[model samples]
Target: MTPTQATAARRSKISPERAQELYAAVLDELREHGYEALTMEGVAARACCGKSTLYRQWRTKPQLVAAALRAHRRGTLAAVDTGTLAGDLREAARIAAGTSGRDTRLTQALGLAVLSDEELQAALREALVEPELAAFGAMVQRAADRGEIAAGHPALEFLPAQLMGVLRIRPVLEGRYADAAYMERFVDASVLPALGLAPAP
Candidate 1:
């Protein structure tokens, strides 16, 4: 194993419950203090763990944040399968809406730090963006296979952007986070129409 991997493997293992607590603490610290002001010392204190443990486990702040995000979103979108594209999309929208407020706050918290820090940017994309995209792509592919929409439909490419855009912009435009009802309506009114599919009944 590489030295980094070797070191990581040698570090004491954290139980799943303990890990969740630590991740929660990390996100709580991030939301309250923002990325620039967040520190490993603060997280360790909040999580009630040694600073050395945090460093040993995650090695960097970006990595810890990424891990926390991944853990938070684990199995969320991937579990959506309703046997229809419209149903799946609506389900995904519902899931996105559930966390919209907290996630929006988290994104706002990170703000320009994400732009300036390459590691943070890449980590965030890997943790938050890529998995959801993959899940959405899988749902679309299944829909195509079921002949719900044309495989070459132009709207497929914009689906993720559309859903994510509404989630991110609703707060800015309406001063409110997108809720499940709003997201479902968006899927019915905007997304389904664009894909030449009818709204879910």
Candidate 2:
């Protein structure tokens, strides 16, 4: 057989489990080294696979990182039906706080880079921001239907921003991670009051 044929034969097709392993390795590397320092080689090494494996799965670093984030994305708010916006917000906050500190660190690590890199920006938004916004929007609609909040409340438009802002900044301001209790408190103290709703029972 020709050398080209031999090389092609040696390239194993990546399986779902193997791909998940690589995605996790990429997140681990990002947590350890930050996005700016992450490399295909580092992820490959961490995943115990060849660089060609990653390159074959994702053509570029941005794509690889994005894919990794998407792979690990949570569906915390997908089925959130607390019957009230306040309750939903509190529940959402609780779920978000369950995320590991590593995920939070990886997010902060990618902040500046997302500003300058369009692809990275889109990936970050798609993997992180968009899903949360979509689910929150759904919760708001449900609240409107239940008469807990007005459909046209101005604060309705900013709920995602408010929650995301607190989650992102708490570590900087408090020198501590935003845990479930903190999130629930923020929802009760800030989120509900802003929307003219009472705190959850």
Candidate 3:
């Protein structure tokens, strides 16, 4: 089909609930079979929808997977407000630790494929990375406003990387997922100290 026709096909509305179902099916397929092995036909079969429907909606595997990742986004960090930067960072750490295993596995599954596929890389950033970065920025801004941390503290720039890096790296370095306790300790030991703050009592 022509580009215009493809764009029109993509504009066809699917219910929010149905879209979520399809997205879940796509994630499940990705988890069970890494990106290289995932197929539009498999997603169609798993979602119990017609293959043509998948094609009409997303046009290709990269588009479909991107949509799925976007739809699956949960703004977990955006909700954190513990009244202090240290408390907020600890809460964020706890939350990240809670899902570290599942998320790490998903990241690993999509690792090389996402690096090569611009569409997937952009989707991952939009769906996962950017949201968290925004949330952390908000948290840091709030802390600065409250005078809990200096506005120009260098560590502020690295907060997201510090938290996300630990979550992604623990499994690689220790062969164990970063748990809530470990994450909380990390915030106390590494993150807070870097900002010249101490863990909240």
- Number of the predicted model whose TM-score against the real structure is largest: 1
lDDT of 1 at 189: 93
Pick by lDDT: which candidate is best?
1
TM-score, structure 1 vs. true: 0.91
TM-score, one value per model: 0.91, 0.86, 0.86
Query: Candidate 3: misplaced stretches above 4 Å?
Result: 1-12, 70-75
Model 3: per-residue lDDT, tens digit, 1-201? 965366446745787788889989999999999999999999999999999988888777877776777556444899999998888988998888878887788778886998898877765675577888999989989988998878889878888888899988988999999999999989888888889998878
Looking at candidate 2, the ten consecutive residues that score lowest on lDDT are 3-12
Task: Give each model's clash number.
Answer: 0, 0, 0
Candidate 2: tens digits of C-alpha lDDT, residues 170-196: 888888888888999988888888899
At residue 86, give the lDDT of candidate 1: 94
Measured by C-alpha RMSD in angstroms, how accurate is candidate 2?
6.4
2 against 3, candidate with superior lDDT: 3
